[model samples]
Target: MAAGIEHGRRSRPNIRIIAWAGAAALLLVPLVAMQVTQEVAWDVTDFAFFGGLLLSVGGAYELLVRASGNATYRAAAAIALAGVFLLVWVNAAVGIIGSEADNANLLFAGVIATGVAGACLARLQPRGMARALVATALAQALVGMVALMGRLGVMSSAWPGDIFAATGFFAGLWLLSAWLFGRAARA
Candidate 1:
């Protein structure tokens, strides 16, 4: 409590406010685009969904991050959050499998569920987070393996390769997050 302010963090004014405002501004883009073109038609439900997602992401960051933690920890948290955010966004929008409408896409949902459940189990501790993220990486890869073996998204271009690539990319991100968390634990 030196100088009645937290150290390690830069004394930047309105950073949290700016982050929330920026998130709100992003929602405006789609709203403005809908006004600009008929092709960009987005209903009220779409706006609600996106708004909810952004709020949840921001809220999660605020809740899970420890401001006093080391840079490695912060980086680990950011990487994990971004990875999860992109995973949910891509899965919801186009899906890693054939399309958003495909039943196979449901598998990706489990990957997210696994991570959330593991995070709960770990209580967000660094060592436990590292293990939880490893579990998440495995879950991500398992979804891809299932899609490959089950011939999911066969109608899509490059079939198995796309599944492999997408799943591999996400799994790699999870593994990297896990590695970072592990390093943070060590430090």
Candidate 2:
């Protein structure tokens, strides 16, 4: 029993490090792609940075929820995820993040709505919460694909690459969130 406890203690940090590294890689891929393609010049407000931050936060939330085994932590994580969606929407609306044509506002609004609905469902049906979270993750992926296709100079000049990048970044984050939440549920 003592050996098992000691082994668990030693393994926790390794698990966290692996999670962080994976999140960093996911966040960096698109940014590197953008820089290589010259789609946009690198800047501080780049989507990769935001993506990394969101992933880190989501991962941290998961770790905390798992460690504490607290429902409140899970609820807070859900709320924080929703807040991130809302922030993206606001950024798109003000033209601070994406182009006018990207329609980030609408995409983010849908995400926010879905996230809120998922949270509500989670409260009512804990057993199916993971499914709701997974659905939100997929929705984010759809938004990313739309944003990406609309950008890259495919449809029109109105499409914004920044918005596409943001969506893609958050989609990755949501994927991480779903995995973490699912794992927590299982454990």
Per-residue CA lDDT of model 1 for 66-175, tens digit only, reads: 54257787777778887887887887788789987888988877888888888889888878888988999999988888888888889987787778888888888889
How do the residues 18-80 of candidate 2 rate in per-residue lDDT, one tens digit apiece?
756776786677677876787645566666556755675666456545644545446536554
Q: Which stretches of candidate 1 lie over 4 Å from their true place?
A: 1-10
lDDT scores of the candidates, listed in order: 0.83, 0.57
RMSD of each: 3.3, 8.6
Cα misplacement distance, residue 12 of candidate 1 (Å): 2.1
Best by TM-score: 1
Top candidate (lDDT): 1
Model 1 C-alpha RMSD to native: 3.3
Predicted candidate 2, C-alpha RMSD:
8.6
